[model samples]
Target: MKGHTIGELRIGQSASFTKTISEHDVYTFAGVTGDLNPAHIDEVYAKGTQFRGRIAHGMLSAGLISAVIGMQLPGPGTIYVGQELSFRAPVRIGDTITATVTVEQLDPGRNRAVLRTVCTDQDGTCVVDGTTRIMPPKE
Candidate 1:
């Protein structure tokens, strides 16, 4: 696995990944996680609720942040030990979401890093936000 060691990290360093939310993505996520909330899968039911239409699961958008941390910032060998996530807005199928991770603090003594993570829709609205602690790869 390829990734930056904690020694190589600097506060404010960042990376991101973007993916369009698709029906398949949502359905597959629901199946994989058993998070088949009617808000996400039942359009007829959703239309009667606050969202007025089917909305994707919040964690599905947050998973995009994992993509950034695992494949971009700390890259392949990073190990997440903690995270805090806030779901702010609904993510609908067809929305293009961008998940970004920025190095917020580095703890060389403990081989850990604090990263600020967020997910925004194409409209630039933040849909998810949080901070995560990880043990970055040593090599």
Candidate 2:
């Protein structure tokens, strides 16, 4: 499927996806990325950290934003170029995260788009927020 071209996009255009963090997901992410940090894998070790329990890898939630951009908005053939992110809160296993992407700005002349990306937990806490730039497929 072709992606939304610049001409078809508008400011405030948005999309999202939600997922519940699970132990298997975290472990799989850790195994694949080789980021076996204690906070993500070792409950006993994590208990001593500021979070007082295990927390999912921050990028796991960030990946959800990618889902929205690649599958929802300027979807399918969209090319991800740049991303800036900030992890605002800890996300634990079993927490549901909703990742949202809104068109905050567009540079049609450059075939560029900047989207406001946010990930919120079930409690409505903003666990992650950032911006991403993409070159939406013109076709």
TM-score of each: 0.98, 0.98
lDDT of 1: 0.94
Error of 2 at 80 (Å): 1.1
Q: List the residue pairs that clash in candidate 1.
A: none
Among all windows of 10 consecutive residues in model 2, the one with the lowest summed lDDT is 1-10
Model 2's TM-score against the true structure: 0.98
Q: How much is 67 displaced in model 1, in angstroms?
A: 0.5
Write the residue-wise lDDT of candidate 1 on 114-134 in tens digits.
999999999999999999999
Off by over 4 Å in 2: none
lDDT of each: 0.94, 0.95
> At residue 84, what lDDT does model 1 achieve?
100
